[model samples]
Target: GGPAKGEGQATGGCPVYSHPAQLTDNRNCVLCMTCLKACPHRSVEFNLRPPGIELWTTHQPMGHEVALLFLLWGAVLVHRLPEIAERLQLPQLLARFDYHALATVVLLAAPGGVAWGLYQLNRLGNPCLQGRPFVQVAYGWLPMVLLSSLAHYLTLGLTEAGRIIPVTLATFGLATAGPIWVAHPAVIAFLQAVSLLLGALLSILLIQRIAQQPWLRLLPLHGMTVGMTVCLYQLIV
Candidate 1:
């Protein structure tokens, strides 16, 4: 059939894509494998394992994926802008626009800076590689960026998300056998510090691997990363 909408139910769950449950309308999939089998070009495939594993490893010409990740990271930065601005006591430079709105606009307008930096590093690292190096080298820095994100939000998430377990149990008329664990502020801080430092170190290592010690090129990126880490530590943690 041309359409799989009315097709028979699939055996187990939606194989619509790698992350069906993450979709807004995953409930409507009916576990149908139509999309999986109907592709004329055979572009569809399945990954039954954890997400982000590929990012943790080397893949080539990942510009599209890097773009998505940068957009996501931009959104994260926007989400925390209010707290950051408040903590910094920054004045509202744009009177007519919401600060957060302006921040988001900035993200949309200039999201490729990270990839561009990566491209430059790649050029310096490997002269023979003909492909644009942005996406390829960008993957190497993902660990640093993601770990920074975790360190930034660790305290808040541990406190807030931990309640979901107890709340869900109460909603179902069930009981928790023990009190939910909340990380002490000091412990959280220690973890956050480690995460920040680890992210910086990983980024340094990635830069080295890509360029075999292109110190001049790396100086700016390293400073930026460490500066952002310090800013986050001072403001949020």
Candidate 2:
């Protein structure tokens, strides 16, 4: 017979009804791949698509999920905090506190604080949005957040990933030439910049689509997104 039924829906071991779009809902998925393995007909298939498309399309994030996004954003900031602090001439201030403790605070607070402040400005500028949940509009930042994280890590991937070749060869006591094909610093920087630019553009478009308000009213949110992109570009590149 076919797959067993649970309340009339196929019991495919998916908590979210095996809905492709809902799979993009990160909070509900543990990435276990049980649905794929459990499907008797091998009908489940994973396809690649544009990154962050679900943010503007079908992902309806809740308040806690929005908080999780900010947490991830804060992690990006924490990863670059040393450079940021030095650039801001806060090295002395940073010295007084334990590095791990400070990073903990930044990881917990920075993004959420900035997001909350921007949310207030958004509400003030767009009075019509006062009744809407902040989480609803905050989804607009999803693209920027995801792309910025990717760009931040791109540096390590481009510069360090090539070392695995030599490292793997040396691990077996074999002679090695060197890193196979590391990207030039300039090229890596350029790619990082391009990634941030794309993220900023997508973020602005998403904000406009989500808000559906006058351009003037949307300026604060747009400014926030652009400002973050600029800050991340400076830190990462």
Candidate 3:
């Protein structure tokens, strides 16, 4: 077949391999299933491969899948923010404490969520293939996990701010930050914990839905029921 101009010809610093007239162009291979079945590492597959043939070295194949999974479930963490704000009356109470720190913490936690999700993906064999090595999953999730654990500390800050400020009636006095401190301080301490709990439950439920597993429906429902119970307890106390 005659080569069309600017088509088959290699251009722009293309390397020329002197061996068997194999086009030597990365783009030339057709994914004909030959190379994949032949690969010893079993890293190649039709789902991920282009229509023709190609070779990937050190293909962290699981990276992106894991990323996607984590991201999908992680969306739940943000989803509940509005409800949380409303349930806790965050907007009205915003003036009671140091929002600067709370906002900063939230900003920090958002990125942390993304990082942990990436890490979890890596741990699960990079289920989404984000290109980071599988071994680094711990380091990836470390920040979010630690920060999540400390979420309750945010309430402590609020309470501390209230205590330091001498304004009494003009404020809820020091009690403004009191809600966070006493309002199920354990739960408030780790907002991301709820995020994770719900996020994980959501991920599992989604998988169950796709597979139509009868048991999957209970996971989210159970989580919701438990969360509601906690909310009730917080309110009563």
Best by TM-score: 2
The alpha-carbon RMSD values of the candidates against the true structure, listed in the order shown, are: 8.4, 4.8, 18.3
Query: Once superposed on the true structure, which residue ranges of model 1 sit more than 4 Å away at CA?
Result: 1-58, 88-98, 107-111, 114-132, 169-178
Tens-digit lDDT string for candidate 3 (93-120): 3444566346445643553354455445
TM-score of 1: 0.60
How would you order the candidates by TM-score, starting with the best? 2, 1, 3
Tell me the deviation in Å of residue 122 in model 3: 18
Assess each prediction's global lDDT (C-alpha) against the native. Answer: 0.61, 0.75, 0.39
* Candidate 2 vs candidate 3, lDDT winner: 2
Q: Write the per-residue lDDT of candidate 2 for residues 21-134, one digit (tens) a residue.
A: 455556567776655555555466668997656665777768887888888888888888788778877775467667657666866677678777877877776565543456
TM-score of candidate 2 to 2 decimals: 0.75
| lDDT comparison, 1 vs 3, better candidate | 1
- Writing each residue's lDDT as its tens digit, candidate 1 over 1-237 gives 123544343343335444433554333466656645544344556658643443334334445777876666566566666775666676572333777577666754343575476467756775664542455555556666688678878977777676777877877889764367687888888888888788777876665565444566556556656765676567556
Candidate 2, residue 81: lDDT: 75
Among the numbered candidates, top lDDT falls to: 2
Q: Estimate each model's TM-score.
A: 0.60, 0.75, 0.24
